[model samples]
Target: MITAKTMATGLAFAVLTGGTYAGASTPKVKPNIVFILVDDLGHGDVGFNGSTYYETPHIDQLANDGLVIKNAYMYPTCSPSRTALATGKQSFRTGVYTVPVLEKGNDQVSIFSRWTVGEEHIMYSQPLADAGYKSIHLGKWHLVGPYPKKEMEASWPLKKKLGQPKPSDFSWVPYHKEHCKAYYPEGRGYLKNIGGTYRGDPALEVGGYKSKTGGYFAPFSNPFMDQKNPKDKWLTDHLTTEAINFMDEHKEGPFFINLHYYTVHRPVVARSEELTEKYMNKLGDPKTGQGMETGKKKLTTAQYATMIESLDDNVGRIAEFLDQKGLRENTLIIFTSDNGQNIGSNLQLRGKKGYIYEAGIRVPAFVNWPGKVDARRTETPVMVTDYFPTFMELAGIDYRGQLDGQSFAPLFKGEDKALQARPIFWHLASEYRNGTCSIIRKNDMKLIQFLATGELELYDLKKDPKEENNLALKNPETAQLLLKELTGWRKANNVPLPPNSSLPY
Candidate 1:
């Protein structure tokens, strides 16, 4: 175990730096971490997930080299899932259940604590930072704003820049980019931060849409497109490059990089002309920038294929970077999405993006730690909330506060029972576009309740993984038993109130 004195004495650093790349001494195993989190990539969307329609070869490579959790989960959508991930706790516990667009300082509507990222709570990066790891976050910071247009026009941050539209799109409120400081990778305790969007960039020039960050616009537009002095790199390349540089500088010390991306999220075109042409006009016009007609046809073979292919390529780049740096053997590379895939993302999943269905909550999770972890696929049910405790245990760090998750570190070392079979709970008081209000899945037996009408449905996922069969009617007693378990689980986790935030000073 890495004790406080060991960490303070720079043992982790000395161990990390002493060995050469090709020539090894003690394997130079300091365990650099790279966490690739895609925004809105779904369960049924990739080539690995029985997707004959789309290709995600790069993402699939991690599966060949690491454990792929088939039943991995997150919250129903972006902000909520992200919140759960950062805190290792639920949204309600942080009072951050929905997408927050307003800033506490700016003329924004969403309060950080009461609406989005709870101001009263700290995040996972804090623990990593305490251990002297550099935490870096990139792309798709969506919870910050729908921003008030009037305040954005007069806001100090936005006003400092020249020739930009006022954040007037969010009614009269300004985009709440300030509250983002609390949860941003650097704010949470990263050594540095790369990319995150507080408000939509106005220069993409989609005729109908004034703001160009969220929704269906450009699939993978460069974040530095409007920069006066732009860097010559693709979005994925830039993220990977920064990661490599960080590793180079801290080759001996531990580092945590949150390599987030806005891939296959919306605007399903690739950056290359050849790839973009395949998706262009197949789904929507890139120049005109609009989505395909509803019910007319969602994802074209080319568009869907391109989206998956590009995302794969982007993920694969990180793998390639690791190989080049000779950091492949010791580093733990975890690839996961914030939530499930979105529309046109896949067909096997019933719902997309913002719903509480299996498609929205279930995600593809791959952890690649060369030579350390067995390169095999596992059906262990895991959740995003479990990562905080898992990493802490893995890095041998200490913490004074409470966390809602258990460490899956033993599983990485080829140990059993680390994927401990437990009832993972998800409580969402917010609106789901479709699907039921609440759900409980354990040991392949799932129960969903439509809270509006007090209706209940049960499915044996082992028999009907797609949730086609409803066994609640046939087994009322069994359904009641599971429902009781769900209630009990929620209470045990401190589901509603924010424990850390609610404490009296």
Candidate 2:
């Protein structure tokens, strides 16, 4: 398949060749890009997304300054969603399948390029590199698979067979205050890289911003665990400090800093015992966490509430950092999540972090770029695939071929509207190999096709926000129309046919 991420380069090439317009005055100001992606954060997790249970003051402030895509969406899992964001195309096209794929044997590693011939032009780094902007990807690299061991290729059949997760018997996260070859920030295409937990702090040497981490194992603590200071600041604080420093150093030129956070995911432990106690107290009585497997202790609605609060604080720090540096104007600060989560809060949405349901796929996205967009809400359904195109627009890059994503930049600049006729498609073929064959938002009106059972479900999102009403049989014509579009999309993208192929049967 001609992956669309690289195709967008044609757009960039054309724009660059068009050169400076005779009458156009090139703005001396070069904008910086901040792509903030959180792992497993969902529609109900933040205040903007209806999480009244906990506050999101920073996110709220961002919304005040920029437009929030009320209908922003991503795949239900990490790798595929990240792949779409990285490639601006569905996982199937890039071989991601919109779902996580695990390999127990050596026959294949699962991720498309994991088994493909040449380096799939899926990662956005190389293109951004070619664009003269410093691009960095920190935090959870769940998309490129396990860190360190997996150095993506200029070509594939990746000699580094994506490895097994290191047993997290100890603190998967440690307060290592040094950055070395193991920590290659600029080498990783990021001028700065202060990723959390799984990807240790490369900041003692490298510079960047923060937001921070967790994980689990039924037994053991690090024998060498830093007892020197039983209580060090939470890893998030360190991350933020570095991020601020990075911005301070790089504000002179155009840069892309992806400050990824590994918080609000798993292990559910606090940075310190006191904070844990504070959280436990906040949960009040505790039926809410009974029979839960949070590891350290039973959680209360309060601890969940506290964890979210801490995450919010991290957001505020980054925004405040930008304000302090006066970098808020030309910098495009985008906040989004890799997938969905159910750690806390309630927003009547069904499903959790890994399902294709709206609850799982719909994510919280707010862009705070002054003068670029208005502080309002939009119901235009945008997807992770859209970022490849959107970033190109920000960089003044033009694409020259068919792209799966339509740049929402027009909408952000006030040139478009919320409701458009374009259809967003998703294919999660890996799950079929694991169990059921499922395709979502299949029709224009939206249908779910379950190949295993030969069952189909339909809903009109306009009439039923909860997707409770079935309209497939009630309106077969609409269903068929949508199915046709979806099938064509898959076919055009070279997504395998179902069953015998990588698609569904």
**Clash statistics: count for each candidate:** 10, 21
lDDT of 1 by residue, 1-505 (tens): 2235533333333233231111112222447888888777777666566654455777777877787777889987777777778767666566544453312222121223322353334466776777677677666654343332333344332311112234333321222334345544555577676556543222233432334433223333323223323253345555566666677887766777787776656544435557645654454433212233334343343554565676687678778877887878778988888877665544455456666667778888878888888877666678777888767765666543445566665566564563556767776543435422457777778887654454788988777766777899998988998888876665555454222122111
Model 2's alpha-carbon lDDT is 0.56
Per-residue lDDT of candidate 2, residues 132-209 (tens digit): 776655555544333333333334433223432343422223322232223333333454443422322122111111
Q: How far is each candidate from the true structure, as Cα RMSD in Å?
A: 9.5, 7.6
lDDT of each: 0.59, 0.56
lDDT value for model 1: 0.59
Q: Against the correct fold, how does model 1 do in TM-score?
A: 0.75
- Say what the RMSD of model 1 is: 9.5
- In terms of lDDT, the poorest run of 10 residues in model 1 is 19-28
Query: Highest lDDT, which number?
Result: 1
Model 2 Cα displacement at 235 (Å)? 2.3
What local lDDT does model 1 show for residue 75? Answer: 80
For candidate 1, the per-residue lDDT at 101 reads: 36
